[model samples]
Target: MGKKYSDIKEKLQIVVDKKTTNDLAHLTHYFQNHKNGVSQCFRSSATEYLSELHEELNIAEEPNFQYYLPIKWDIPFPPTENPTFKFIDLFAGIGGIRLAYQNNGGKCVFTSEWDTYAKKTYEANFGEVPFGDITQISEKDIPDHDVLLGGFPCQPFSIAGVSKKNSLGRKHGFLDETQGTLFFDIARIIKHKKPKAFMLENVKNLVSHDKKKTFKVIISTLEKLGYNVHFKILNGKHYVPQNRERIIIVGFKKTVFKSKETFEFPDPQESNFVFKDILEPKVDDKYTLSDKLWNYLQEHARKHKAKGNGFGFGLTDLNGISRTISARYYKDGSEVLIPQKGKNPRRLTPRECARLQGFPDKFIIPVSNNQAYKQFGNSVVTPLIQAVAKNIVKELSKINESNQSKIAVHK
Candidate 1:
């Protein structure tokens, strides 16, 4: 049985003092029922106690904290007195990042994607198809925009590719791999256009890729391009019900705005999401795997267990978050297995896959189930992107306000 409220309170008081009787009551109830673990309970209780302390001390809220609260990082940017900031979507896989920025009142001046099927889905939803082959298109051909966004290809730096490339004796850095070389294209565009800011997303392994040399080069190259670079590893589980980790890099054009301080990534919000919250009750029969495949998976699990490698598919319960979905999900749905009744395990429907990535029901999926699975598995979480975009807009607003103030002083 769980500990009683009074016993828990007594234990908590040793670390947290100065709580009123009413505050303690609320905190005790919170701990007994909250979905998160003790750490969350402690953090929430501490926050509530701190607020009360602030009132007692007559201290004002910090400027950043005041601005941070109540701003739904998940929602798009609020309308501004300044005209809507323009942004371009690069490597726009089905426009996940594009939707986040668009929801925030930012306009897309250009979009680029090389995948034909992804282009179809993107156009079906966004009303305009992305131009093909960013490598072929010059920076001058692209329209001017305040921001740039992309989750560049991750194949080259991935463990799978590194192993293959090392055997071939080809160059291993970003410049050698087909997808790795694309960063040069992004850097060249930034050098020429100098957008107010840009955001790049990639797998978390990118930080430690090639024993840190790969990351060091990326940083130094962007710095030479005259931008202040900031990066953080953000997890999708914080905003959505999936455990996907990615590195987000934000760069500010030094000529437009100069700041010595680093940008702070948004704090993790309370997550109430679960697998059941996104599942489709009446999925098509095609998504259900056959008994033969199910048996194979069980046998695979046992074999891998003997060898000490995890070969079995990961099964996510209705009450918990999901593991990361990958492009190979279409080939074998091995990463995200759903439970079935007295039968073989099943794969999530295409629509369920979309929901896992935070795509709304209204977002059209014009491709085949296999294609849909691959696309969403490769996409970003809209809420996560939207929240980070909000922070970027806030910083840009400051720069705009500062410019106006300087003009007024001159007058």
Candidate 2:
């Protein structure tokens, strides 16, 4: 009998643990997608990896060599059995955007993330390991899909990114070839695959980066690819108890929507969540700040205040929203710190960070606390992404229905 995901899950990891390449990503992705049309994209590589594993382990395969059984989908976030549309996730940080699209009836055919710790967390919850280094992956290698979803690397255009780069006498934005060119990879894939629609999420500062020139180039490039682009700055505060803002860029193929797609970004929902809503009733004492660190934070805040600067640790109001949680949150937890009754304010526990990003309690955090904090801090507010994805999917359905009607009339 072919092995189920559960049957060989440990063996596969053993194989993965022994590898230095990204072949395990292919193997896991193939196991998840084999029965679907998406498998062809991964089969050759996955099969080779599986064969190597079987030989090394001295396990005899069936005469025909059944690489996998129908996947049991025993992971925390399995793919939908019957998907309404397909999408690809780029820069998929721990599957935040993936969850949003999946909830909206979209199947993720491909996903890529380069971070080792983030990939571990993603595979733990989603069952499939993601391909790494999107820049090295060819556009033609990606599967065709209805939508492309990416919360692309934003540090190149963020305020903090620019400030740090300036201090180090380094380039930021488009001038930073190391990271800035990643957007072109997204554009390259879009131009090749020509998905019906796409959604990109980035730091709010992206709109004003390089004096708006960078944003202008991005918009113009999509237009040149024959897409009708619409974008807006949306805040997570409306969905989560955090005042985080990001720019969402949506594009539809002009040939598909004819510049007449009736798509609109979702209006901000009511802010019903508060800081305490996501906080744990009982947190470990280790999360509490050290007296030395607390005193240093206080003195640092005083000096910044004296200099007329707004830089300081934010002691969150239990009943109110918090400042934006950031990837640097793990360093000092200065952006959003919880107050204690008698002790120094504490950093948010890893689980609390996940909750703040609208992740469910069932979501697994298999990484270290520091890595978990960074992953969640870099993630999207799930409910907010879902709200927007709902609208996008609705429009895609309408477009499909219209196309079907045209075909029926012609027949």
Candidate 3:
């Protein structure tokens, strides 16, 4: 009953309003989920957004707001058709994880990200603008999903608060330990939604952060939530030309898997890739380091080498994997620099960075080069993520099949 997304999208381009950004997000998300049984989660707000847009533009034609229209998606990654399972994306940076899961037959019913530039790139590729700031959104507003996915940032738990709570004989569970941090938002949502499975990604250093207290609390928190938690530190080199290592934490609901889950992290495979595999043939001269900066970097390396410190710029070997690409790579490209034939070392182009992270060429980049660096640096290895997601989906399918057979026998 609702108007076509293409028609409203054309009208939205001519509007000069800034506050309507969030409204457009609702409209897109509503339309994206219309056939997925989760449209009700966004229907009310989307209906209101369309009505106001029509009024402000003073369009003579009255549009019916009932249900979804058959939309021909113009985006690179449209919503999956007849998805076997549903998931929600939190802290979804440019949808790297969502892509892997979507490729595994999982439909993303809801997504939330806080950055403005990242949202633009996400919308350009997925055709749905993510809701901003997960901290501001309530858990109940999110649709019911089979799995939850997030790559959340974490802060150290306050020791003083823990001592004070213990002294007062108060229960200091995950809600107390993870409070005042982004992980708390994730914990709270899991406590409310009770999804069958969940996956979280973080820097490998998290395993030893705050002397391992942080990781212990995280595991215990999930245990208290009635889920069997499994974790591993996985390297991206198994699937990409980058040596990025991240910690993946996975959980399965005890009620569903019955505490007998046999989930195993994917074994690392031999890497057939090298640094040169992701290089661009004809890069612009601007990517090359300037003469002055190049000399300064050499001097910096010499000083650190003399002192036996490993804090120097990395000039990657063409035949080997490169160092981890970081979000701060846009600053100086010091971590993973490429060697040049007759000049100073150069930085990886945005497209090369995308390939290093296993992102496909068709993925759109609607932001500046600096923003692209940050987004790609902060993203996961898509092929590696897809490998893990395939296992998760396969496990869920087996469980669902077993349950169906039991019901059939009972009947």
Flag the better candidate by lDDT, 1 or 2: 2
Every model's TM-score:
0.77, 0.97, 0.90
Best by lDDT: 2
| Steric clash pairs (candidate 3) | none
Residue 402 local lDDT, model 2: 93
All candidates in order of TM-score, best leading: 2, 3, 1
Question: Per-model C-alpha lDDT, please?
Answer: 0.74, 0.89, 0.83
Query: Mind sharing the TM-score for model 2?
Result: 0.97
Clashing pairs in 2: none
lDDT of 2 by residue, 1-411 (tens): 445565677755433222336687878777777777988898899888877877777776641236456656667788887899999999999999999999999889999988888887888888877888899999989988999999999999999999999999999998899888899999999999999999999999999998899999999999999999999999999999999999999999999988998899999888878899998888889999999999999999999999999999999999999999999999999999999888899999999999999999999998889989899989999999999999999999999899899999999
What 10-residue stretch in candidate 3 is worst by lDDT?
Answer: 153-162
Candidate that beats the other on TM-score, 1 or 3, i.e. the better one: 3
For candidate 2, the lDDT comes to 0.89
